[model samples]
Target: MATPAADLANWIPRLLATWRAARRTQRRGGPRPPLDALLPDELREVAAAVTRLSTGLTRERELAGARYLDDERLLGAYLLFYWPISYLQARGVLSELPRLPRTVLDLGSGPGPLAFAALDAGAVAVTACDRAKQALTAARDLARLAGARLTTRDWNPTQGTPLASLTGGTPPDLITLGHVINELWKGEGAEEKRAALLESAARALAPGGSLVVIEPALRDTSRGLLRVRDLLVSRGFAVRAPCLFRGACPALLKESDWCHAERAIDPPPLVAQIGKAAGLRKEAVKMSYLVLAPPGEPWAAPPPGVVLRIVSEPLAGKGRLRYMGCGPDGRKGLALQEKHVGDANRRFETLKRGDVVALEGTEPRGDGLALGAGSRVTVLAEAGRPVPMPVDGQA
Candidate 1:
């Protein structure tokens, strides 16, 4: 449903303007800042801070609960580099919503990447809530620069009022937690707290609304999200997208395996430069996410026949092409022998992770469904493409 940075191409200039205005270092009457501000020196500084911030958030785990975003350099680093990543990530997930959200509430909205992304994706009213005052200020700055209307509030679940306080009397059509829940509680029963918060939000959601939770794709975080998903599922809640299985997640059976999706992206020039200088890859964005429906909303029925989401990248062997797919039947391997790749099933030769595909023909081979001469391949949804719901068809 969402292609990539192209959907947000106009965001490039507005973000540059906001960052440039914040720096306030341009000489009087000097040339305006280019869309891709190739300020090598500034890029180096931002990249160095990006390297530190990235490490602290991903590897070192020291800044999990800290106010690192308050640091001028660190915030700048996030604005130029990580903001685009989160923005694109949100768009990818937003593409899967059953309906476009008219009202959105983004919790832990650091400098408002996801909140603003919601606005760009067509949300009419959005409230960006975060405890970091400095971050909220930046959100305002970005909003002003873009000439876009946004609501900013200070709300930290750890300290502030209950989650219900932020919603006022009217429930939001969409509530988003972008890389926020993992930062809360950090100790025993963290997963429970995360699930509890999401459940509350789901219950409070407007009818036909969605509650989206996006987390880091790190193995531990991904598994933690799966555990939370299981908890919510056990309580009789249903998922809107990404889970064809109605039961506890099958990916968690193996300790080493986790679920995450990679969507193609072409980083803006400065983002690529900063990433290169920081020793990171910026070609694509990756995250583990859940799209949960409000209470009483049932899971969209799966398409007819054998259908599964390609969970793993193509696992090609000497004579076969294989992928792990998770569907209503639970997770299973899908294999097609090289000799069996014909006109009908030749589409299997090019398969990407996150693609929802249907398989027909052939008996079971090793660990999955195999394809043979009679087999026909149909791609119900490509990576990042939205799946059809019952509202659209037979689901």
Candidate 2:
């Protein structure tokens, strides 16, 4: 029942303590100042390192899958800043799962942010797997400080390692690969290889379990995830959330456009300070994620009536409210003129990127559908909440 934000409230200071302890070269006997009260110079230093780390991971592509986290300064920046973001993103995606996961396996888990996130979100058993030893050690240290049980393993999928090696011979209810799928198997036929890895994970899933994939919101990464999604869907896998178009991904019809989701956040104080100094935006969390059921499982039936998942933020126009929605019918433009906006359909004016909306009295217009004054709009699900399964038109 604990929301990611509510649970993360307990993790912020423990993360700070672990990060501070990691920086110590010698044990000091006396009382030392709290690391939460970072000095101006210290903040500036970490911010500069954060800027560099962000560049290498996002823009430069120099540190995408590298051992950047082994470096103390960059690792500190990650633990203090990016770790919270990953935790929030993982928790948000987990919230959309149809069934709460009892056990989780977090692949390529640097410092085990997603691993800890799974624990905080109610997963009883979790294993953080990665190839980097320092990152795994950091994860262990944080677990020690939080008094939470965590498991860590050395995992390198590039060597063609099967997930069974890390599963302790028992499949987890949920397996998460956060921001690490795109970094694997570079060059030609990479999409096929990624799909293969996902297929293996899907085969290893417990009955009614889910394999959750979270990637960065960058254009290339998101498109890559879409391609992998298409491959799995082609392989007869069923997506549990974030996709109503059960066929090929419509977002990949174009080269420039990609799909992603975003949600507003009240970041921790230290994260805000680090963001201010690093020149990064921490106000809203953004990522491309997918939750897929194993083969033979069917997609959840759409609630009665015309339902569509709002897949875009508000598109700018002079007098019309416009968004792109993907549903069983396919992806199409959804428009509502400002003049036609009334009490019934006013909620459509401020829909988020991931909100699932149900409509009544909609008419086909341009490429999609239009809402008139008589139209009624109901939000079936918020950005992170799970969409309810309707029975006899009742949710």
Candidate 3:
């Protein structure tokens, strides 16, 4: 009972084989020695057309093969590697640089894969850009699957000044060039082209932000992962990779590609509803400790000797919570419960980018100052003076 549609689909492979055979014949004996050996421009149009078709076909298959990826946890593991790699690189840069990145920008973001992943993981927003309109459309569709917002652009990195326009008015916390660097470098004046691309990336980088380049680990060192690593290092990035970072890069791969697509399915309506609410709202405020006021006034107790600044603000509906303290490097530090001597639920949103606040009740740790991610603050400071802090709005 198979319809003509199904019948034609079954015959696709044979048709493709026949077409490829004709193409091979033309390349091998019809004036050209070999398809790849020909001058680059000779195959530009054909290559681009093939690339578009391939991408379109792949998407169609992914949509059709949804059932296959549904039960695949292995695919999730491999997809997770990209984020950790980005985090490690960003952290490595921060160790040597003065500022920390506040945003992540993913370029050549295929299907908005890494961009949306970042948003789910931690980034405030994900800007997914690509040269192909079709690719951007696919990426936007993918973003819809997650109920997340994405800003997409049509851009080809190889030609035109579109990169400059795309990045205008805003600098990115991190610039990611995944799999596209090699293709961009294939034309004439490859070095100049690469430098031009890097210069653009460098210009768009926020203070202390990193430019991430990841390519296939192919034999062509000049056009593969090795080249990307070297190029980034030469641009003054503190390079850290599986090859460089000792045991830092874990194998995110599994037996099959299933690991990467496990999360592709839409969650149940109830679960999705709850998740959407969670995604829409600000996270719960975590109070380090409750500072008790003596009788009439809450300010009776003298402020602690050393007060930390408030790196984050409180939630809109909650006023009893407040986060205070800056890391030794001026980066925000989370106010932990173990360090607070007062009531629980006093710690507000983990300290964010700005806000000069302090804590009271506990003593400062070591040299009366804490450094690094998990620092302790005995007292939380306030902005200018300890006026009543405003409640945060529902995010």
lDDT of each: 0.85, 0.88, 0.38
Off by over 4 Å in 2: 24-31, 390-395
Candidate 2: pairs in clash: none
Greater TM-score among 1 and 3 belongs to: 1
What is the TM-score (0 to 1) of candidate 3?
A: 0.37
| Residue-level lDDT tens digits of model 2 in 112-228 | 889998898888999999988888999999899888899999888888777998998998999999999888888899889999989999889998999999999999999999999
In order of lDDT, best first, we have 2, 1, 3
Off by over 4 Å in 1: 1-4, 24-33, 391-395
What's model 1's TM-score?
A: 0.94
Clashes of each: 1, 0, 27
Cα lDDT for residue 141, candidate 3: 52
- Ten-residue stretch with the least lDDT total in model 2: 24-33
By how many angstroms RMSD does model 3 differ from the true structure? 19.7
For candidate 2, the per-residue lDDT at 338 reads 92
Model 3, residue 199: C-alpha shift (Å) = 3.0
Query: Which wins on lDDT, candidate 2 or candidate 3?
Result: 2
- TM-score on alpha carbons, each prediction: 0.94, 0.95, 0.37
**lDDT tens per residue, model 1, 287-368:** 9999999988778888888888999888989898888989888988888889877898988888888889888775776666
On TM-score, the leading prediction is 2
Q: Which candidate has the top score in lDDT?
A: 2
lDDT of 3 by residue, 137-194 (tens): 5456545544567788766665565555766567777666654555564435665666
